[model samples]
Target: MSIFGKFHVPSSAFALHETLTAVPEMAIEIERVVVTDEVLTPYFWISGVSPSAFETAARDDQTIQQIKKLDEFADSALYRAEWTAQVQSVLYAYTEIEAVILEATGTDQRWELRIRFDDRDQLGAFQDYCERHRIAFSLQQLTQLSQPKTGGQYGLTPKQQEALVAAWEAGYFETPKEAALTDVADELGITQQSLSKRLQRANQALIGNTLVVSAEYAAPDAPDPDLKH
Candidate 1:
């Protein structure tokens, strides 16, 4: 069974470190990190930055091989960039990453990442990779998944979990509508659209982890799939 583990990689190991170093006040939350066209494109939602300052910081930062703004919205913007070959090697070395979230803000430079692996061998290989490259990293948390896709809380992001709980308690899923999205959004100090998106994403993750397993076990037909992509 795969074990769930949370690890911390110091700021020096991330390509964004240089940008963060340049703009100490800026903070980023990773929405996704994907490998495309032989490059790692990390989509981040940046906060505590004005568009002008963000642009200036990214432009001035040279540690990252390349960077480009992908999209922008009110109070948040998305960015994509490529890391060095040594950084790329660590990501490719691991077959699966359960989750990766940016932790710390306001001059505290560090990234708390949660990842999953098949066994100790895989985790050890990654540690060796980090050591060989001299990347400062440490394991923070570890837990055993009950089954594939059955990790505690189904691996929901903290925001997702909190939003899910609020949604349930507020009766957002009720037929009579005991509460509305706007109410939850107001309480959470987020926009309605943001609340909706968070709830939807949370639902998807929960369904993927819990219901998918239930259906797979209950299905009578050969390889019956309950999930829709």
Candidate 2:
């Protein structure tokens, strides 16, 4: 069975953390990360204001200084680097465990990673790796993804169920809007785009299931006046 795990690790123990911590106004949402040899290539979005400081920080900060190249795209930035031994350890752990990160985001305080693994063994190996690294890791949620969605969460998948519930509790869909998409996404341990897609799908599923049958033309058994045999 596949395992979906939401985890947190301190910024101090991770790369790109310094750059984020330097700009509290900035929220970084990772689009993708590739680990190879001793290098990491990460593509991410920088939310908030347009940033000039990113280039400067990449040159100045000890962690970010390791970056070999930085490319700015229309919607996101990408960095290529030979990471530190510490960062290597973290990435290597994923390899040994057959795991992949589905989503990751970081603020000044910490990094949240939503990772998926092929099975329990991979998870156990990853857990041990965290313990060995002395990384202060917190597992927020874990579910077996191979199983069918149950619990009558309105036919929502586990991640969708969690995201919808989190958004509602955080008031993302409420009157006057108690919370913004950023806040709701942050609370749900996902990026804003990911959260947007999840909420969209959830809303679509709910509306389709609840209201489709009520349409005047929806009933299958009713005689169709427009149809002639």
Error of 2 at 84 (Å): 4.2
Stretches of candidate 1 exceeding 4 Å from the true structure: 63-66, 86-108, 150-162, 179-197, 200-229
Name the top TM-score candidate: 1
Error of 2 at 117 (Å): 1.1
Q: Report how far residue 47 has shifted in candidate 2, in Å.
A: 1.7
Alpha-carbon error at 78 in model 2, in Å?
5.7
Instruction: Write the residue-wise lDDT of candidate 2 on 129-209 in tens digits.
Output: 878878778889898765576523343444566777898898878899999999987786666776776576566556655
Clashing pairs in 2: none
lDDT of every model, 2 decimals: 0.59, 0.60
- Scored by lDDT, model 2 comes in at 0.60
